[model samples]
Target chain A: MGKKITIEPVTRVEGHGKVTIHLDNDNNFERSRLHIVEFRGFEKFIQGRPYWEAPVTVQRLCGICPVSHHLAAAKAMDVIVGAGTGDGLTPTGEKMRRLMHYGQVFQSHVLHFFHLASPDLLFGIDGDPAIRNVIGIAKMHKDLAVQAVMMRKYGQEIIKVTAGKKIHGTGAIPGGINKHLSLKEKMSLLDGKDPMNADKMIEWSLGGLEFFKNFHKANKDLIDNFAAFPSKHLSLVRKDGALDLYHGVIRAIDADGKKILNDVDSQDYLEHIAEEVKSWSYMKFPYLRKYGPKDGWYRVGPLSRMNTAEFIPSPLAQKEFEIFKAYTNGKPNHSSMHYHWARLIEILHCAEMMKDLLNDPDLMEGELVTKGTKSYEGVGLLEAPRGTLFHHYRINKDDQITMANLIVSTTNNNMPMNLAVESATKQFISGQDKITEGMLNAVEVSIRAYDPCLSCATHAIGKLPLQVKLYDSKNNLIDKRTKD
Target chain B: MEKKQKILFYGYGNIGRQDDGVGVVFSEQLSKWVEDNNLQNIDFDSNYQLNIEDAENIKNYDIVFFVDASTKESVNNFDISSIEPNSDVSFTMHAVSPGFILNICSEIGEHQPKSFLVQIKGYEWEFQQPLTAKTENNLQKTLIFFKKYLKKLLIEKKIEEIDLKSLLKIKND
Candidate 1:
């Protein structure tokens, strides 16, 4: 029997998780696995609820990215409504929904980059944990911190204006949004008069891109090869192969950036994908149908979205995307650290897209919602901030939900994340009992790159506590650690 | 002229959990109370959990009261005590303790707010379970105590004289 090293509740990321590293008798690495400990039975609980309430109900799954669930559920309900009315949302309705969804993407990405990821990138991952936080960033670079807060506030404001609240907003409904953007609210965001105006947000996003570029240039090895591995990439893209977060066909690309699957409808998710469960963890591993469990594991989120999209429609974002691609020699950049870079670029795109949507005259002339024919089954898909999120539901004749299945982004990236943890552990951990905080942080960084939401991915319900244990060849615990 | 201290009532817990939501529910009531009484320089907010970002939020406030549910039955209906920022930060971003948030605030902000954790006794944590009668009674008692204590501080403008331990001892009896 070999020794084991574990790091529980990987810090600065959302939810609860633990990492276990196995070492042989000679103190050499054997294997490692990241376990999600939280359990949420959102799918089962919503069974008796009305179909229209799914949007509001599922939002409780994640406080950080509730809008993603909100919109995904609404889209699923839209399918149900479409069955009865012979159509889905009206043109105005769809446009408004897209606007709200972009706001969510913008806010979530901003929060991740500034609040969660930047603390690590700005302050070295090995820096003092006491000061390696948002506060530290504020102290070190006041201007950057101020700008980050402004940018996040701007994104949150967009969400508030569209969804009616910053976190658990109730804007999206069965067929469409309940309200349209008022002129005053729209102008407040776009006009330069406000502290967090659209111009400043765009400028800050571009500056963020440059900052990341310089950081990557300085830490080339860490940026390019840290947890770097080949895997499949998945995201949603417009029919013409443009980046589309709100509505589009699901696309899958190979490790080498070659398109393997294209234009798969969200409704047909089961036919193409299946979930494999492991007895050790609460999360379910989802992989492509063709490759089976072991080889079918794919990556999703910002890195995946950037790898699969043909071009970003927004001008500044497209320019940055070109630079991003050039860095990879026109190939998909497999470096996990680039997730931060791709995230900043997406934030730029989201900001620009928000401006474009706000300027469109149709956004102001919407009838808010469209009454659709009721359907028994529906599925909704969209690019959540973390990755592609799918919501599937089956309803009875009485309009109560009969069954619900949610494939969150974290679940889709489960296999890749485990691979990342294993790779980092093998590369960093040297001795059986010589485990350093830096070694643990290296593993944490790999998982943070994915921004996994364990609270939303798990199906069980209870308190999730994380513990890291180190064992000797005799399988006796030599060192044990926990975060409380 | 002495500056009127800006106060923040921050209540955080998961509302979906039965009595674990007492802090949030209490904050809601306090917000309405503040508005009804037209208390100036007072702010209120609640969420499912606290995060590292909340450090920046508390920077400008002069005083902050962090209200959360405590499962300890031996304690008083609610306990109030001063809290200092600790260097330890949680591994997860989903939830953070008030002391840690304070530590971050003190580390980054130009000023550190005088803070206290108002822990109310909670009995249940089941999903979708309503607040227990005991929790409700405790919540009412805590709210009544805060209403008087805050009025005194706000009217007298003597934040320094507001003794947290004395208040706890008095409320315990």
Candidate 2:
């Protein structure tokens, strides 16, 4: 037996995940695996519940991204209720949901960059684990930290108003929305107090982008090549190939930017996608069915979204998008660390979308819902903060959910995460006499780029402090380290 | 009677999970009781979990009670501990601790509220399951004890004048 090292419950990510590396007798790397230890039974839990309860019931899957689940479930139920597909909702209903979604993406991406990713960027990976966190950012960069808190608060306030409450919001219904944006709410969000309004959000968003661009300019090597690898990318793009997070057709591109899965209706996702189950991890690896499981594994989330979209619709983001595109010369970017750069662009885009939505008159007055002939089966797909989220449902005659299937964003990126860990281990941990904190963090940094929500993927609750254990050639425990 | 100090009871938990909802339920039940009895200078809020924004929300109150459900073996029925600003960060930043929120509040806000964490013991945590019978009993006892504690707190001129130990003694009844 050779040495085996395990990093259990990766820190800083939203949920619990573990990484294991096998080394040959000479301490050279043999293999690595990213394991999701938490098990999810949300599909089973939703089976017997009334179909109408899905939006609220699914929020229990994750406290961090409940709005994503809420909206996705409602979109799925919309089909069962005979609301046409993505374009079927009333103008007010669609716009309201889009505002809620943009709020979710803005806050979620902000949380990922500021709270989880910035600490690593500010303090070197090998920096003292105790001080390498958001608190440390607060101590050293007070202005940045305060800006993050207020920006996050602003996004949450948007959710509160649009979703109708903070937790388990019931604003998005089956066919449409339950309420329109009132004048008071509209004015408050559009031109509220100094830092709480839309303009401030857009301003801070630009600032965040500038911060990342400066960091990238300084740390080109680490940002571009740390865990870089070539792989396929996947996401939903608008009919004209614009980046549309709320609704779109599924599209995918190979490493060389060749279209493998052309624009396909979201309802036909099963025809083009399939999930493979591995015994080592609780999460499933989703792949393009045309290539089969072996060669079909692809990357998703911020980096992939950047690779897949042809152009950004918003003006500011489009300008940034062009710069991002010119970097790769219209080729797909496979760098894992660049996910942060792509995510910041998305934040700016979301902020711009929110401003436009807040100013639209339809939000203040319009039909709330549109109904049509009932359909028993429906599929809902949206660009969640992490990646593409698929919600499929089948309802019985009694209106109870008889079958439910959910392919959360984290699951979609499982294979890419594993590949990232493998790349990091080969580069940073191979043939090492001692595994330094920096080496261990190098492996973690690759995984963090995707911002995987293990709790959402596994539908469970637990802490995510990291623990690493080393085993010698005889499979004996040789050393251990823990960060709580 | 002295001027009433603004107090807030902020509860946080996943209500869809069995027993984990005790904290949120505690807030909802107590808010109704306060309204029915015409209690003044009290406010309530609940969420799936606490986050950075809460620091700003709690900073406005003169005093705050953060309630949650705990599964620690050491906790029998419940436990109440005063929280102070500490920067020890949680491994997962998905949700933050009361101490962390307090630290952030002190860092950014104009006023720092006196804060306490109230933990109600919970048993199960399955999805969509209602609060277990044993957990319900514990919640009832905690609610009864809290009503008296608040009444005493509102009447007293100083927060220090209220004896937490004496109020805890009422838990047996």
Candidate 3:
């Protein structure tokens, strides 16, 4: 028996997960596994509920990104309603849903960058864990911290104004949103009266891009090669191949930036995607259907979305997108850390899109919803802040959900997260003595780059804090550290 | 006359679980009491868990009560103790403890509000289960005790005017 290292309940992102590194007989690194510990059985419990209730009920799965689940479920329900009627959702309703969804994506991305990822970036990853947090950042850089809070608050305000609340807002529905954005709400966001006004958010987003650009330039080695690996990318793109988060056809590109699938209808997701379950962890691995379980694994979320999209439609984001691609030599950037950069770009695009949507007069005055044909089964897809989210539901004629299946972003990136951890452990952890707290944190940093939502991914109970334990060849505990 | 201090009651836990929702229940009752009595300078909020953003939220408050359900057997049905900020920060950004939130506030804000944790004993934690009968009984007992206790703390000008009856009732109840 060789030494083994384990990081239980990886922290800083949503949900609960653990990392275990197995060593060979010679004390060399064998492999590392990221274990998702919490499981909620959302798929099983959601059955028997009315299909119309899914958009609202599923939002409870994740407090951090409830809007994503809500919209995804609403989109799926749209198909069900459209099945009964020949026509789908009205154009007004679709646009309203898009506006609300952009709010969610914007807020979620801002939260990730400012609160979760910035602590590590601003302060060195290997710095003292005690002060390497949002608080630490606030103490050192008051202006940046205040701006970050205001930025996040602006995103939340967008959600609150458009949806209903900052978290778990019941805005989207089967055909469209429950309500349209009132002129008061629209003007509040657009007008500079609010501290976190739209114009300021756009400005901050651009500043954010510049900050990340400078950071990347300063730390090229860490930013470019940290947990870097080749993998297929998946996202949704418009007909013209522009990045579209709310509505678009599925597009997948290989590691070499070669298109594997283009313009696949979200309704046909089942035909192109399949999930493989492992007994070791609660999370299921989803892969491209054509490649089977072995070679079918693909990555999603910010990095994948940026790579798969032809170009960003928003001006500021489009400019940053070019610089983003230049970093990878026009190929898919494999570095896990770059996920942070890609996420910021998406945020910039979302802010710009929000401004565009709010400016449209048709959005303010319209029939928010239309009666759609009721169908037995339907699938809804959207680009969640983390990645693409799919909500599939089967309902009987009574409109009660008979079956529900959700392939969240965290589940899609499970394989890559595990691989990233393994890669990080191999690169950083040399021997038993070298497995310091900082090294353990490095492994966790790689996992955090994906921003896995373990709570939403797992259907189990009990909070699992981050705990790392090391064992000797004889299976004796050598060292133990836990983050409460 | 001195200005009334701003107080915030932050209750956090999964309400779907049987007893884990005690914090939320307490906060709800507290909110009702505050509203009924027309208590000014007091605010109530509850959520699934604490986040980093909450630190800044607590900066303006003069005092904060962090309520949550506790599984520790040694603890009484209802326990209240003053809490201080600590430097142990979590990299996991999803959920944070009240102490951690206070620590963040202390670092970011000009003043750190006096804070306390009110832990209510919980009996069950099953998914989708309602509050267990035992836990419900404990919650009611804790509520009455705090109702009288918080009243004095709010009304009295000095700590010397405080009586230990409201505090002792927890052990007896």
Candidate 4:
């Protein structure tokens, strides 16, 4: 048995989070825990602010996926303001806004999969820590680097064309998008329709896939290709059997793969869903309608979304469906590590949707604004780079926001993260003297597996105070300091 | 052209940790002043850390200010100072540190330029919160420094407007 170890303040992602890895009495490894520490007051803060300000305020939650926050908040607010009186997006406005949203999905997914998520797959979790970055990946795999950069670049162009900015754009006013798309931008999106970039990226992904498949094949004992755990999916499904982003009702399924409710109304979402308060940390856990702290644990965002969607929307992504459906378990191919596969699946879907939107007739022809000036209370929900987002607002007769609430996707998936870390901790904990950095990083990476956007989860990033003291066998202080 | 007194401020720190993002907060104030007052202060770029290479043309600026977090002995950010120029000016890993950025650019053949560091004293560095009370108070002091600078600049302008010919009117008579 070896000494126990602890890792506080995990790094390499947005915002703040804490990860603790437990070592056995022998000191090898026993368990791992990735806890969401920082609590964002956005949810509690918005209680008094007007709903009209929800989109604008929540958009600031994340600089990366402002569009997602904008759309999600707007959609929810729309339900509140009206039964959906075709809220102010003129024909052109709808196309433009949808394009921008999909553009974000494309770019954010690509970033998460490639830059953020790639190291775990390409280098392997226990691989060199110093080199698990874009620059390192580029050095070892130049072709992959080029393809990934191009794919990400294409996604950025989508946002630039629609919102006139890549990351954060002041698109939403009280009614509709504040900006319009230009013909030149439309031409560029059409240019991406070229089979070349997609083909090249696909080729790179295939190569990277082989590298992993081969490793798993070679190290069957160390890496179980079928190492999967069961979990329910949550997402918005269109009336037809398709994945809907812009507007659709939220749905939650059970572990038995049964839909709890086919059409969960966004207006009454707070009723069916509950965010559990954790005293140990700032992050909140969302439980199911029937399940409470005792049994109501679930997942959200990409993994949950894939579970909920009827099938993949893009041809490239559909091929994944073909492969996964052939598997016996039939629930997203089982392997939790394969979440990256689902992310790539969504990226292809987003790109395809973006292309279709560019070709939509109303995209370039109609006014960007419509008549929503009658009443200003509206909510827009954006899929965000991470997952399902909620933005609610209630404006007075003067259109001044009087109340607001934002329940971020990270808050929803916080429970799943705790679960995943526990599972990984159980596997990695061995009785030995050494508590390696690789072991600790693996626990943190599992949290990163969810692409935790602490920034969005916490509207503001501030330093309060935390300290950790390490001790030797003699009880002498080895190291202790404050976070910088 | 007077080169416009072009300066590029790099605000680099971990925002989650109080006082770490002093550079960013200070940069925000400088940015507002430049925009509202239309000063030749040029640009402010905030990052998770600092990068000296970003200061490609250091000599271009008549004055450059570097703001960041420091715990060095006897040197609190509340007490600003000038650091000696050197190669490999150390900044943070993710982004450039203000002090490291100022020195590295000078060594990298960008030519030496006048530099000042306004390091803010850090309180808590791990928890997710905004600036600590002490740091926030220090920020006010930094703002005062800028306000005084603005006033001095105004005085200099007024003094310049009084031409030598006006003072020599008796001699001309």
Instruction: Give the candidate number with the greatest TM-score.
Output: 2
Which 10 successive residues of model 3 chain A have the least lDDT summed? A83-92
Q: Taking the tens digit of each residue's C-alpha lDDT, what string does model 2 give over B13-101?
A: 99999888889999999999999989888899999888987887887778888999999998888888778888767767656899998
What interface RMSD does every candidate have?
Answer: 2.9, 1.2, 2.6, 8.9
Candidate 1, pairs of clashing residues: A11-B91, A39-A460, A84-A373, A84-A374, A85-A373
Q: Per-residue lDDT tens digits of candidate 1, residues A1-484?
A: 5788878777777777888888897778888888887766778778898898888878667667778898899888988887222136776677777777787788778777877788778778787876777767767877776676667667767878778765457888888887778899889988846456888788888888888889988999998998999889999898899999888888999988888877787788899899999988889999999989988889999999999999999999999999989987888889898899999999999989888888877777857787756779999999998999999999999999999999999899999999899878877884545777767888999999988878778743334455678887777998787655
TM-score of each prediction = 0.92, 0.96, 0.90, 0.71
Give candidates' CA RMSD values in order. Answer: 3.0, 2.3, 3.4, 8.7
Residue-level error in angstroms, candidate 1, position A349: 1.2
Residue A107 displacement (Å), model 1: 3.0
In candidate 4, what are the lDDT values of residues A1-484, reduced to their tens digit?
Answer: 2233445565445556666554444555455455556556655555556565665555545555667776777565545544362233566766677777877786676666666667666777777766665445555765555556566656666666676543235565444566666667766667545532434445444554455456556655434332246676676666564666676677878776788867666656667777777676677677766777656766777666667777766676677656645543665534555566566666666766766776687776666555432444444454565677766566676555666667777777777777777766656645434445565556666677677777667666533222333444444555564433
| Candidate 2 wrong stretches, greater than 4 Å | B1-5, B159-173
Ordered by TM-score, highest first, the candidates read 2, 1, 3, 4
Winning candidate number (DockQ): 2
- Model 3 TM: 0.90
lDDT of 1: 0.81
Candidate 2: the clashing residue pairs are none
Clashes of each: 5, 0, 19, 47
- Candidate 1 chain B: minimum summed lDDT over ten consecutive residues — where? B87-96
- On TM-score, who's better, 3 or 4? 3
Q: Report chain B TM per candidate.
A: 0.89, 0.88, 0.85, 0.71
Q: What value does the lDDT take at residue A476 in candidate 3?
A: 93
Q: What does DockQ give for each predicted structure?
A: 0.41, 0.67, 0.40, 0.06
